[model samples]
Target chain A: MAVEDKLKIELGKQGVFVTTVNEIYNWGRKNSVWPLQFGLACCAIEMIATTMARYDLARFGAEVFRPSPRQADLMIISGTITKKMAPQVVRLYNQMAEPRYVIAMGACAISGGPFKQGYNVLKGIDRYIPVDVHIPGCPPRPEALIHAFMTLQAKIDAQPLTGTERPRHLDAAAMSEFPVPTQGAHDLEPPANRLVWPLPAPVASGENCG
Target chain B: MASSPYFSLAILFLAALGFGLAPLGLAVAWAKLVSPAKPNAIKNAIYECGLESKGDAWVQFRSAYYLYAIIFLIFDVEAVFLVPFAVAFTGLGISACVAMLVFVLLLAEGLAWAWAKGVLTWA
Candidate 1:
């Protein structure tokens, strides 16, 4: 629960501030999410527009698009993920520091979009790396990207500092490295990280379930 | 001692030091107490651009470029100082003229060293 829940507005109206360590930590983290600078295809144009003055992503405190994954806190997979580019994308996500977030920002990034039929495209980025938010659009408007940012902020805000459900960074047992898929003779070997994307359960022998 | 001017200055100095260092200390404490470090082979890799680094970062450059740089500096300084000296020749005293001459001579010595070493010749 937020510190505001305990103190309520009366104390805030009197000019006294109240907060917990978790509240401060979450507040600081949610505000300054620097996204990794990268784009794959058409959706990248809309992503760029979000950073520009028109949409002004700075109002939400995520104006900076860091060129290096190491410095980035969020990765907006803003375009189509081709089979060839999937490995490199996963590698960049792995390189990012803990408390990192990913927003699958476009139909293409969430799923292969129009390219789903194409042999060269990967179905979805979440199949490889765990995606925090999935935004659906052929190329979503700047407003949509901003909405995604707010959603990510909400997700960050809800995470408990010390608990079983606390974020991946706080949990020592949480896997730091999601195995980067390598090239094979036919396709990317071991297609997806099963930990993130679970395989479908087989049907019972006598079951007539559709 | 409290009434002394330096006492205030000492307090301000300590305040300034704390101002600079307090955030750094808090960040270190936060990392230790809150954030559990998660480092792996890919995360610890040298290059951050997603591409695997090719070849060694340490590579040797030819020393011939050093001689060229030294020769360039000698002439560049000579020209710069000589032009100013010529422009101010009427206002300059005899001692000033001697000082300018000495500066030029020092640069000339560097030129002579480069000439003797055959650094001027392009290999």
Candidate 2:
């Protein structure tokens, strides 16, 4: 046997396949989550709920929430981006080191919803930031937020970058348009930045509501 | 029970005060070391979701909306006080209940005044 083949055979006999390591690492990465500490509006409340006992966002591995942008890999934009605050949102995104993913977390962030007409509101988060996944709802239920995070993981692992597969996020129109409520904190950073994001996963299923 | 209220309230208030102080106070303490000497273009610029900012964000907001918000806050603060009274209904059964009712009535009277003045109307 040739050197490469012989090495493969020996390794296989020892139960160590080089190719398998890639799969294992990918699996681990796809499950573990480190979210950037940021929230723009009321949608952030639902984002926090996902991490609480009922939704338990930790099951899929995203409970760890980092306040400093440098450490976080996931950016869940959870609220409306008004004209005044849009620049700050972008600033926070740029501060985060890459291999990063953005989860647009509300109807307002996804399509500007009712705020699109207002001169101050940005039309969509995608207009400024690169969004990896879109979760639709005025403020989506916590379960949906978890679902969207899973969807992001699946897309990230599917090898879409090499042109082997078309990532689902590439299709923008399929994403939901977010509508803004008249009453909400304008230009306020949501209080959900302080959740126990990286918690121990208790169970796999969320029987409690979404 | 008499002392428990004072004790529990002390603990609760102290805990709240501690929570409020810890992060903000800690941040200010360490900020002198971590903070850069001078503000840069990036530092002054506002945050977009992930994109660069184009224009200034410090534009004017309407004064009328601010007035309405102030009025809303007055009622909001009064409502916040009622929650603690409601939760401890067993403790403050007769006297506290009557006192809260009177307080709420006064707050309602203010709301009525605002309503009559068109300050409460959104349209």
The best candidate by TM-score is 1
What value of lDDT does candidate 2 attain over all alpha carbons? 0.67
Model 2: iRMSD? 12.2
Per-residue CA lDDT of model 1 for A47-94, tens digit only, reads 999999899999989988899888887999989998889989999999
DockQ scores of all models, one per candidate: 0.56, 0.09
Least lDDT summed over 10 consecutive residues: which range in candidate 2 chain B?
B34-43
TM-score of structure candidate 2: 0.45
Q: Worst lDDT window (10 residues) for model 1 chain B?
A: B114-123
Q: lDDT by residue for model 1 over B1-123, one digit each (tens)?
A: 999979989999999999999999999999788665888999999988787899998998997678778888888878988898899999999999999989988988888887888877764
- Please, what are the lDDT tens digits per residue for candidate 2 over residues A85-160? 7656766765654456789988898878767666456556675556789888998999889889989888666533
Best by DockQ: 1
Q: Which stretches of candidate 2 lie over 4 Å from their true place?
A: A1-21, A160-210, B1-123
Candidate 1 residue runs with Cα over 4 Å from true position: A1-32, A52-56, A160-163, A200-210, B1-9, B80-118
Chain B TM-score of candidate 2 stands at: 0.44
